[model samples]
Target: MGSGTPSFLGLLCALLTLRPGSGFYLPGLAPVSFCPAGSSSSDCQVNIQLFVNRLDSIESVLPYEYDFFDFCKDDQEKRPSENLGQVLFGERIETSPYKFSFMKTETCAKVCTKSYDVSKQEERTKLEFLKKGMQLNYQHHWIVDNMPVTWCYTVEDNQKYCNPGFPIGCYVDGNGHPKDACVINVSFNEKNTFYVFNHVDITITYHSGEGEGWTGARLVARLYLLGVLKKVPFQYLWDYILVSMPHTNIQWFSIMNSLVIVLFLSGMVAMIMLRTLHKDIARYNQVDQEEAQEESGWKQVHGDVFRPPRNGMVLSVFLGQGAQIFIMTFITLFLACLGFLSPANRGALMTCAVVLWVLLGTPAGYVSARMYKTFGGEKWKTNVLLTALLCPGIIFADFFVMNLILWVEGSSAAIPFGTLVAVLALWFGISVPLTFVGAYFGFKKQAIEHPVRTNQIPRQIPEQSFFTKPLPGIIMGGILPFGCIFIQLFFILNSIWSHQMYYMFGFLFLVFIILVITCSEATVLLCYFHLCAEDYHWWWRSFLTSSFTAFYLLVYAVHYFFSKLQIIGAASTILYFGYTMIMVLIFFLFTGTIGFFACFWFVSKIYSVVKVD
Candidate 1:
């Protein structure tokens, strides 16, 4: 990698290393000044050191160390300690050869020139690797004073967008087809040749501490290479690049569109609760001794409606896991919205998520044990074990398979054996015990009291129409909820695959709230209509209704892979789907749990208020 900043990711690296500001400064967060090499002490000169991170290509999931690609490595290679999140994300940070002093004007000063003799097989291989890096658009991430080294340029409407990393080089095929970087310069037009960005001129800007009380200044640095080139033309590195910014109008319109649907769904639910249910209850209660009740409706099956569903144990386990996922997602989003996980904080997002999930075992076990007890289950041991192990096991297995692929490819993204062991220790040593403690308390507390009692013998129900069949209703139930989030989903997937900045947490949190409301209302509405048709087997069906939204999500992911992205290679395809499956599973649990609880509450409230003889 080269000399520059990595925005938030760099901030995280700085937080860990905490070494640079050797001068008398404001703890670890201050910006140290720089000056020309011959400056006196009165000039307040600061010696600046630039740090380089991992080199990554968007077309490939694998990232490599800066030194791996035969770039100019530091004479004294000093690697800083990495945190769990940094390690997991494959951020390999090390000192770079580029040095600067504040206000030091650097022109065509030569860096180490690299050469490869094509006749030597080893050198040919190295050259080929460098070309491959350019072909796939590998980037060098550099950090300066805890800020990303941004390359800012004007786009449509004269708006400027800054990119965090710069490319290694540019290439053109034998047919004269060129990448975007190749078209910028005429000298790079040769066929089947790699044009390296060897020479760079970086500009660093900083806010003055003139009026401020602080002696050190906060840096606002940018790098632009216009007039600087290598004395030997062929050997150079990281510099100029640009990409257009996402339009705000479309994103806002999407949010507004989702809001309108949510308003409509909310009105429908309000009408059902305030008007239809109110009249239904009053009318049913007023039925006298002489007038016989209809044996074909919901009231006739109150006894069997409360019966435990098939695979009660499995249902409880799912509920428990869903609870954990729901809590994890909510808290993570809330933290992001509050700027704790902003682009300035780097890998705080992943670090926060992993830590929270490990600590949330209590809620999972508690919800599972309570539900199982309410189902009149006697096997508490099995219930607790399933709650703690089942879903987590599936996730770990999937993760392990993906990690194996990374390992086989020798990607830096591979988790070290030590980190993997640490994760397992956290799971079994901490989370499992916490889950058991929650389950014990859950069991000690009395089982939830149902409003209606279960009958010794289950009652037979009548046939359902095409409209009211469980499959049709469940299928229909997911449409509205999916509609509310599909547009947002597009942006989210784009961020992941394209490596774009995603700091739109406020809108995201709002959409999250809307999604939850839409899921609940849709499930409740469907449950109500089914009960009117005398279907008392509402337990598992209610959960499946909202959970099917995740299926739509999976379908959309497949469509996105084909339509929106140009991702090639079997490894990339496998990695994409593997991660997508994990997301889908978590979403299934989260949405399904939401629908089930809402339906359960609705069923209990209706049966409890009406006169059930």
Candidate 2:
């Protein structure tokens, strides 16, 4: 192990060195100033440029590029300083028409005017679309110095809410009800007409050098400007999530908690296999006449232990999908851990996952076909087709239904018809054929060899006690696995719902390894106990045992929704649970497959080793 350590480190360094930005770096900025377009004033050097991202509404899933809104365009090509994650997430930040100089105090200054002639048909159409986006509560995400320009407002209880994005403009209804943001100014009172916000009052605040040791000024405030077009830009954290936590406390806490659970379970399993099982094997090997009648435990049931399970076709299909998912997840997380899929690169994580899943159909098919054949299944075509279609079909149907809801609600989150077609093409055109190829190869391969001969008659399993019952054992099996992940799950949930940045892939990878270990050990320990109680039916039980962890995950998510989230609305609630169900199903298959294989190996090894006449 010691000799291999240096070689492993050298290889890791080489891989990371070959990949650009595959190592951690702190975010730093060099201050620059801007004066009037041609002015040479040294005091007014701080110039800020606005960048635009896709315009999205809460009611829809489709996001349009900045150009689609017909907003102010930049004169020159200047891209913002973005990280790998930001780029991969489709954040097309570029120079904008709006410019500002560093200001010491909060003073509203006019930035620019966006006058447009509505007489032209093209201009009118663009204006109408922009107004419709505002009517539907579409938000504009702006970035300055890599920080979100937040819109701050007072809500109920006099508490202030800071939204990372601001509205384009507001529309008042014919019935005299002014929109929410429009109520802030009397200038936006035109009924049944789109009031364009053509002017913005900019406010900037900065910390002077005297207080924070900065040589000049540091922008520290998020501000908003309102007009007939109000623009408010409030500065928020850029990369403090990665650097500024309470200093490794959360990571250590999560690690310690998982370690405690893992150590406890590992101790239990170790005691059972090393001490109890060793003695059991020794006593059974003696085979004295006095103990011959008492051989009704696990040793007596060895003849039927290797029997192929009922509904083996479905089980094999799940195992194949599980294997595919396992490989994909491992590679994805490994890339992330190595910083290749760092949060700096926009959309890379999802893109990588989708591409990997598409390319992995062969493994799924191969594993499913091989396992099905081993189970004495004769229907190769059905097995392969089901493996290709079943789980993916279910997830797609759910996603399509959700998309329909988004369409009806007019939310920007809905998938476009073109994108949907492309997805289907990828699945049917590429994935299905690859799965068939894998299945063909899998079917051609010989079935796996068993260690012992099977009995002609299936042995009758004795009635199991409470401790050894399937339900109880499976329920207990999930506890440790869930414990290992619940901490990391919190951060993941935060990143998705709370819009917090998640950049700790190293910690996440560690947790994944722990989850695998916990699931395997817990399942194996329970499988041994069940077999000792003479219950030879373990195929389904072993799979379901660790898969039950997903149930705990669902429960935790529900608790999180009510306890941690302040999200209101039936649509949001429905969307949350709908997506969560998909995650739960995938996790169920992944963890359950790990447990099943571990138990399979353990049972095979122990039974094969004992001397059976």
Candidate 3:
């Protein structure tokens, strides 16, 4: 057959499948049954009308087709029923006989009707008529901006049906319903609703067969509610289902705005290195005694510049921890993008990150021990212990305090005491021992050799510009790299606190790559300028330059809590920033390590490449 013939045949098949009454029930004619009080059978019937609100192009954020039906006996129990047959094809299903009552009218009037007498057909018919008399008033209201919503449920015993999955809310049927009967509810109010677009269904089809035999199909549902109307009062519906508003996308422009300042600094550094310092260095050696004495800028820091940095052991530990965090983050994001730690798997992402970091303690120990030895630190044992405990201890202490609050509050977000103990076991039991092993190997190796020899006395740094001073320069260096990532951070925070599903791994990975590039380039460029300025104390400064972004992140966290968040009480604030500090500390180490290594390479290469007689 010709290509056109195949295409035509496929279209015909699709049309047949999609046509009304072609295996799928018509929209409005779908039957909804209600069981009257004390009646074992469903004695009432009503039609449920499905309507779509405003439509928008951003359906990926909120997708739910109008015709997708949810099944449950009450407002507290909702479950997707459209594909129930497929989901339970081979499963032995069991349901208790419970009275299912439905009321279509806005309000019920007491008619003093006797308890449903199922034995009498006349009484059953009369009850059915009364139920049918209740009219369902369809508002057909359109919501433009969808409200954020959450699905809450509980699982008990070993029964299968008791566990209702995602996009479905859950509640305990406290009215003496079967213990295995899972309850669910969907709300659209600003406080407790899943934001679904009103009127859109998107389907994606793929030709899976190679050479004309492949076929694949996927369907997405969407609903849009107006942002303003979401707040309007509605009696029958819940006021709010979610605790907070759905998080907005990361403001890339705001991040870019901050980055512009860093770029400007980079340009300034470039100008000094290429134009001003190059000539000054060349001219300094050739000048006579008087002119040499007047030598300024970075030219003064030739001696004592490369002296082993103070607290080298601590610095090494910091770098090691940072390296561990960086690798963990990279792997976690990669796996998440690949769909390993998706929303379907609760706690998977954190579990993955923790496992990976614990296993990778070898690298942290190796890097710290090697750096410490190079810094002339002879206490390998101290280095290894510090590497394993110092930073992690600080984080754990903070975490324990936060956990205490969570335990008191009884929030599901709290880590159980057993889990906390397990984390400690992972750290001290697994990670600590691994660090010692790595340190043994690192110390056995020779110290890393520097390309340039250190002068006995430090060169005096010349008076510097306001922007080039240590604090200002270091602070400025972090902005560019942080700018590349703050937008991505917003989404991450939302996924954590707002409980939104974050599946856009592609965008996140791109942002991660951008952050690494920005950190490296910005640090290298600044290190070169400092070296040319004769201020060779680029060791800690280089690390701090990029790491300072963590400070800004902490500031933002504070601002978010005070301004954007409705979280109350000191405990919440303390818990929020305490956990935030752990994040910042890890981030500090990661970014600092990136800058250090980049500067380390730049310093070694530039000095080694140039003939230093």
Candidate 4:
């Protein structure tokens, strides 16, 4: 088996000849220009290189190196350096043997060939493995200009679907059923055989280097195979994909729908705060009506609502974790909206979030310590320790379990021991110490002052109605927030489970804000009702209320698994849910903390403004 010389294999089309010395920057995918490195722009000939990325299947969580399929190999293969996020994602990108010259155009070129005799066991085994890859429907991922080379085809209803990767091959089953790609030609009609794609006709579209605001030559590469001349993608989901005509209208409609819901919730919250609450405060503050007024409504619970919640230590820990997740999510989505984490910078989003979470230990510790102190707890050491270790420990443990599975399965998604050690070092060395520094400062500062003082004896709580019960209220609180993002969640799930590209960061950021408002208002609404009913245990209730959104997320995930996904085998199923639980936990903390702080502020403001004597 060896790479063959480039030879025409299909219909010839337009041939492009870029200037020999034209300089072009291709971010993350290949060279900065069509010239050798360190050469002046005018002094070099074209040096275009095509890179091959890891082959993956939607049927499995694992992705493999380009060389795993044994097609073509660079005589001296070179791999670009990968960042931590890329490594974790199993992005095994390497130089391909397919070479291009500036003045040349190749049509349907043969890249490599492998001839095998069934009598040779080693070659037979290799052939069998390649067939297995076809059976599993693994796709080849080619890249140019830091963008995936797209293979576009017409799906049902005459709509064009551009896939970022193309199938390695197609297989015809014993029953004479053919996979989608096998229908390209009658030559592939033989049953029980695997037909491989040995040739590709690549069309490269480019923005001239001299274009205004151009940092480099921007290129989009597409492969037109057989007679299927599908509409090519200008970029592999250029992040501008959603802003296209039809997509733009649908996305804006979704945004408007969500905005209406958010505005309605905000209006309700504002009405409660500005109108009803004002009347309640005014009537209560009447010179002689204080005592009677204090015996009813939310005002009655002021004395005990501020009391330390049960399981104060654990609650504080969760709050710390939530704070960390919230801040990390905010900054990540914000950066993505600013185009700093565009698809052009592969793996930058995860890297930025991880770095932000690691660096945000100070705020986590400060919030946890301050809250724990406000709860009147004296176990300062234990509080800080839990704040630093508890949530991260659980996540790491889950991740370790998942990694073990990946390791046993020989998946590249498995984290190498050295990388795991580096992560642990980041946690213990940087994050933990920052947590300690924050705790020290938090302890030195005064504990947060409550507007109203707690009585020496706890106030007797009244029985709650079904709707206002702890379980019911928490469960209900998650619904509205989840509603705000469920549409967005569908796109996110498609990106993860279905291998679709998702780059609508501005839309996501808007949904994030709406989710925040929904969570805050829903929790506040419930907290007020609970208080009015004279159930003063609001601390944990507020946290759990918003936290239950994660439960809804879990439910939706389960629904998606059954309805939307075609994943099979126990390992893939477990892997999917295992990863999902991690997401759910992080979301739980993020939302719960938002609700907790919002309710806390509401309680404080209401209590502070009225005379509590």
Candidate 5:
């Protein structure tokens, strides 16, 4: 096939697979190895191993790696596959003893049993931790063939809630309230003792070769571990796969909605540059000196427009952090879109982001120092320190506070002191040095040249209309950008709060692109209007205008919490808002920088083209 033909074919394939009611797996899906629960198949030699991830509680902020729990170890020292993100997230997936081959069956067989004597101090300590995990409702995350092993349970009447991992056990209180995974079984009613699940009934289901284009049986079912036989009749389900996958129609709607906003913004920006600005430039160049004196609009404020803002240091630092975050998010999302950071790889997403942010500190410091120098600041040390520490310190402080809460509650989600130290080391050792390097280079380079010269005396702006007022303009500027993202935001929130797997990063990546364009165009358009209105304070206005989108995100999150989430309790609420605040701040920086740069470019381009004496 020709190069163009392959590209066309790939596009066609993607479109076909994304159609509603289509096959669960994409076309040309690579076959994964699988064996029956008890039997081996010669067709595929890939050993099916159960890999365990960190144990986490929804109520907590810390997550413990699989090794933290003293459970059955792998027969060999072989560690399961993991990506960079997974490693950073402390996912320690090792091979499990329970192995299977294709087309096998075993009926309620005993995998292993643990009988711990409480008299022994070492064993008792381990048991105590295990019991604490049960009390805190920390869940196990098991993966087989890169697919999560789901534990399906009934909740909300007939609605079935299938968790990717089941708890090791549950604690029943004196009040007879079955907590965590114990609700699934009445036999777990022993008041104080941990009813550990010593055994599991494994079932493997696969699509046979009889399916249209498939050559061999492909595993379609997520491995499920039924802790107790008394819970329900022994039955395994593969039907949930079709029901659980995100609906393609909803994705298309989101894409279409974003496209409309993008197209509209594109048209408005094009009109301003091509028709409005073109004519203004032509008129200014042709008009006599007598006529020029009467024209006191954007042209009149040219000298003061590039005047440094009051808090140039702070703005430069924010822009630097924003640039770092922007690049990190873009690369992370793009990798996710390409399936490099798929949900199957535990913690890979966060791992990649953290690693990227650390490595990209150079750009962060460079942007800050360069902008600070442009603002005629000589304090390079202060500029670089703020660039490296300001935003990151705030985030770390918030995270540490959250972690402290988790520790106080004895939740498994708290980060260990060792891990915390390691994180600090990465930040200070790697990221801090990189920022200094970037700032050094940036300072060594000359400050950016503005197209128009600035006057020593600042211009006085006329009283603005309500629509052109700073607050109103900033508020209005964010609406379009927020509109483009609200749909995608729903899924992101669902992934975080509702514990749903997010795999539609392709859609997310597309939405991110749309958001950037929407933010840029919206800010540029608003900046143009303000400039034309004789407002020379476009510096801070442009940044605030796009950054206000974060406020809408906060609003929508509040709406999502009250409307969609069943989350209750002060701890959960506090943690939710705390994390949301961190996200909002980062987003503020990211979007604000985009708007600032866009407006800067627009101002420079327009001024350079017009005839200025």
Candidate 6:
């Protein structure tokens, strides 16, 4: 044990050296200014303090592991480490009051002076004006846990800049270029006593570009806490700046429109299930034998109702994959709730989920192989391998295509080549082998025997009414679950595309639970009706019922792209659908499996308890 300790420590050191950003650190970019003790001049020591609280796990089901950066370190290139700034509250100092202010430089003055002329000519414009004497551009953002903090930017000092609010507190001063002279003040309200002395990380990004209008430059700052700060005291001064901006009524309207559509679909499904369908089922079943015999539809196929579904091996494979998806989703959301996958962790959530899913392939294979055996499937090896590779391969291929497009477009969202290779290794090396092992065990088990025997002759299905048909019912079944999520999906999309933070896993988990219950109940209810009508073909229909939500999701994604997003071009559109297909495919499996099992149980119960001729 003692000998191993040194080796473990060596490994830890190496890991830390390799991944500096993975560990806890104060929020925001390193500061350009630092105040030494005994500095008499206030210009050199503007006190800056930050308070971050409300730390809770976004996920309700997973353990808290700060090791969320496991998937991000694929391509390791050592670039010149630019000084982000000085760390006021590093691991070395536990308790410290820090002051940070930008220094006056010639370049800073020149950048600010040029902006002053533009502001003077346009008095009506509320841009961040810099005088010939200003030196630094300062911007700050205050985010309340999971909420969005909106910002805008400008160009000055040959740099891109942004302010937290209007009338930018940051400006270019007398310097010919940009300098770190701006000071930002921060403090906590009286109610924010729970967090103190805890280090919060902050990042400030600068961008320079020339697009629409006068050369564009912008600087933006983000802040986050490293640990929980319960009941701590801190104070600092804040400079309030104002600026003119366009109202975002259109954006809000688009969100509202999506909500309305979701609500309308939900209401229709609810009405059909709760009142009309329920009453119809009871009334139809209460009819006398002669009348019931005369009435024919799904009831004609009653004798073959217990016949085993075809292609059970494929279905089992799907279920296995669905189980993996379900678990992955559950754990991801649970961790997000805990703040481990907070916006500050960029790509950490995806990395964590993929890693978890890969590790979980054993269960997927085990479940699929067991089910295939129960269905009397002979090709255990093929079933297991396909279960492991087929669906995941499709998704990965689609994702790779999208990544290629992103790479071409120089989009920030593209996954790197090394990460892609890591993904492949995870799928083929770990998940696939585990799946085969699971299938081996599953093939050894006995086939499941139905309580009611299947008839030799096929039962003829009667013509279904428009509402009773599979297409309409399946389409209708998805509306309720989608309603529960469409509102949440809006925020998720915003986070993914608009570069906003999403930390509301609590609400998301609830919605997920609601969706599960809704899908199960809707599928079971529909299956029961068709069964009573004597239809034995409920197998595929049941699966399709809940899986239909994927179509709705695809439709909504298209609508969102067209109306809500500013993205352009054929490649962007193709990339969007390529990714959307992965999401839809996963959803199809999850909901379809839920419906299948629920209906399966319902059919088994009804048939086992009924009196048969």
lDDT of 5 at 535: 96
- Per-residue lDDT, model 5, residue 550, is 96
* Least well predicted 10-residue stretch by lDDT in candidate 3: 7-16
How well does model 3 score by local distance difference test? 0.53
RMSD of each: 6.6, 12.4, 16.5, 4.3, 10.4, 17.2
Of the two candidates 2 and 4, the one with more favorable TM-score, higher being better, is 4
Question: Candidate 2, TM-score vs. the true structure?
Answer: 0.73
TM value for model 1: 0.88
Candidate 4 vs. true structure, TM-score = 0.90
| lDDT over C-alpha atoms for residue 45 of model 1 | 49
Off by over 4 Å in 5: 1-47, 54-84, 87-105, 111-140, 151-163, 166-200, 206-243
lDDT by residue for model 2 (1-613), tens: 0111111110000000001111123222343333333553564445665677666554433455666676756667477564433433335566776655544232343333344456677766665667666676666777665456656665677655555566666777887577756787776666675554444555544444445333544444434445444334333434333443332578779988998888988999899889989888898888874675577678887878888999999999999999889989999999888767764455668878878888999999999999899888999999999999999999999888877776676544566687678778989999899999999999999997767778999988787789899889989989889988998899898766655457778888888988998999999988988888989999999999999999999999999888887655677678778888889989998998899889989998888778776
State every prediction's TM-score relative to the real structure: 0.88, 0.73, 0.60, 0.90, 0.79, 0.59
| Top TM-score prediction, candidate number | 4
CA deviation > 4 Å runs, candidate 4? 1-45, 107-110, 119-121, 183-187, 209-247, 287-295
> Residue 464 of candidate 5: its Cα lDDT?
94
| Candidate 6 ranges beyond 4 A from true positions | 1-302
Model 3: lDDT of residue 84: 19
Q: After superposition, which runs of candidate 2 have C-alpha atoms over 4 Å from their true positions?
A: 1-49, 54-140, 144-239, 245-247, 288-293
- Write model 4 residue lDDT over 1-613, tens digit each, in one string: 1111122122223334343132223223333434324533653346567699988787777666777766768887999988888877767889988776544576545455556666778766667767777778888887765666666655678766666688877788877787657775566666676666664445554444455443444343333443332332323434323322134566677788788888888899889889998988897777464465545888877778788888998998899888988989999999898778877788888889889989999999998898888888899999999999988998899888988988887676788899899999999999999999888888888999988888889878877789878898988899889888887888889877777777778899998998898899999988888887888889999999998999999999999988987677788888899989998999999999999999999889888987777
The positional error of residue 478 in candidate 5, measured at the CA in angstroms, is 1.4
Model 3 residue 342 CA deviation in Å: 2.4
Runs off by more than 4 Å, candidate 3 = 1-303
Residue-pair clashes per candidate: 15, 42, 40, 1, 12, 72
In model 3, how large is the Cα lDDT of residue 146? 18
| Tens-place lDDT digits, model 1, residues 1-613 | 1111111011000111111211222222334443345643553446667788887766776778888788877788898777777877777789988776665455555557676666778877777777778888887777765555644555568676655567777777878787756665666667776666665655555555556654444344344443322221111111222123454666788789988988898899899899988987888788863442553467777888889999999999999989888898899999888767765565777888888888999999999999999999999999999999999999999989989988887777788999999999989998999899889888888988988888898887788899899999999999989998998898788767765556678788888998898899999999998988888999999999999999999999999988887676788789889989999999999999999999999999899997866
